[model samples]
Target: MGRRVIALKPLSKENVTSFYQWLNDPEVIRYSLSLFQKLNTEADIDFWYKGVLRDTKTLSLGIYVDEEFVGYAGISSLSSVNKSGEYYIFIGNKDFWSKGVGTEVTRQIIEIAFVEKELERLMLTVSVPNQGGVKAYKKAGFKEEGRLRNAALRDGEFHDKIIMSILKSEYKLS
Candidate 1:
């Protein structure tokens, strides 16, 4: 198959079902902090969606690949005074994994957070077991700031969360 063009658009109700499914997927949630909690109902999903919409500090976007909603991306925990934010992205479509989609999504969100929003820094926390995610963030200019020892409990065991970040001064549009 030809490579599908990737794009980012504002999150809307239209993509909520896909978002809901992605959040519930074991493989997808395994790398995320959400793995600690169970999201079992559509009502729970709706509540989360509404929360995202109501949160003034977050800028959530849908990840599209040639007109198909494949994932989600966003900047949350924004602080105007500190000029900082938290970055997030996930490709719901398993077919797109390891295909540079995550990296592209990360790059796009960084542009929006730093250049468009003029945020000073963007940071994220990822499970240490998610090597692909860590590498992708590093490739997108995020540096390892520190580790939260035994911060996450998953699959009946405790795991570390690695904090990574990039500053506006360090970002270079490529």
Candidate 2:
């Protein structure tokens, strides 16, 4: 199998339509906090889109596979003094899920955060039941730092959340 060409680009206004669909997708929202968000239409995401574009402290980019918008990844809550930020990703396109795209996107984000952005650390939180997401982050050298018990409430039940991170000194491009 050949590697799929994956590229990250600035999240655009056009992508919001896909974003609206992804946010409403049960499968896509199952592992993330989007499950708790109530987004009714593309208009519902307007504020979010505008905020993402205006936020200087956040780097949110769309994940494009062969020129089609599939998902988005971001580094938020950036702190210059602490040299760290919170990382998150959403591979909303089911066609690309479990195809190693998440791992590649994670690697790219780590590189940008640690090398190009000159950040010292990048951290992320994931639902414990999201095995695919956990695997991708681990494959990209993020270690489990902690676990928050009953952190996410879904379907009238509580799920644990895992905190994972990677340091600049620990990163190695593969």
Candidate models: Cα lDDT each: 0.85, 0.85
Give residue 19's lDDT in candidate 1 (0 to 100): 59
Q: How would you encode candidate 1's per-residue C-alpha lDDT over 1-174 as one tens digit per residue?
A: 997798999888767788567777778777764631677578887877777777888888888888888888899898999999999887878988998889888988999998899999999999998899998889889999999999888778899999999998899987
How far in Å is the alpha carbon of 54 misplaced in model 1?
1.9
Backbone-clash count (model 1)? 0
- Can you write out model 2's per-residue Cα lDDT over 1-174, one digit (the tens) per residue? 766799999987778778777887777788765532676566667777777788999899999998999999989999989999999888889999888778888988988898888899999999988887888788788899999999987777889999999999999866
Worst 10 residues of 1 by lDDT: 31-40
Tell how far residue 142 is off in model 1, in angstroms. Answer: 0.8
For each of the candidates, give the backbone clash count: 0, 0
Regions of candidate 1 where Cα sits further than 4 Å from its true position: none
Residue 170 CA error for candidate 1 (Å)? 1.2
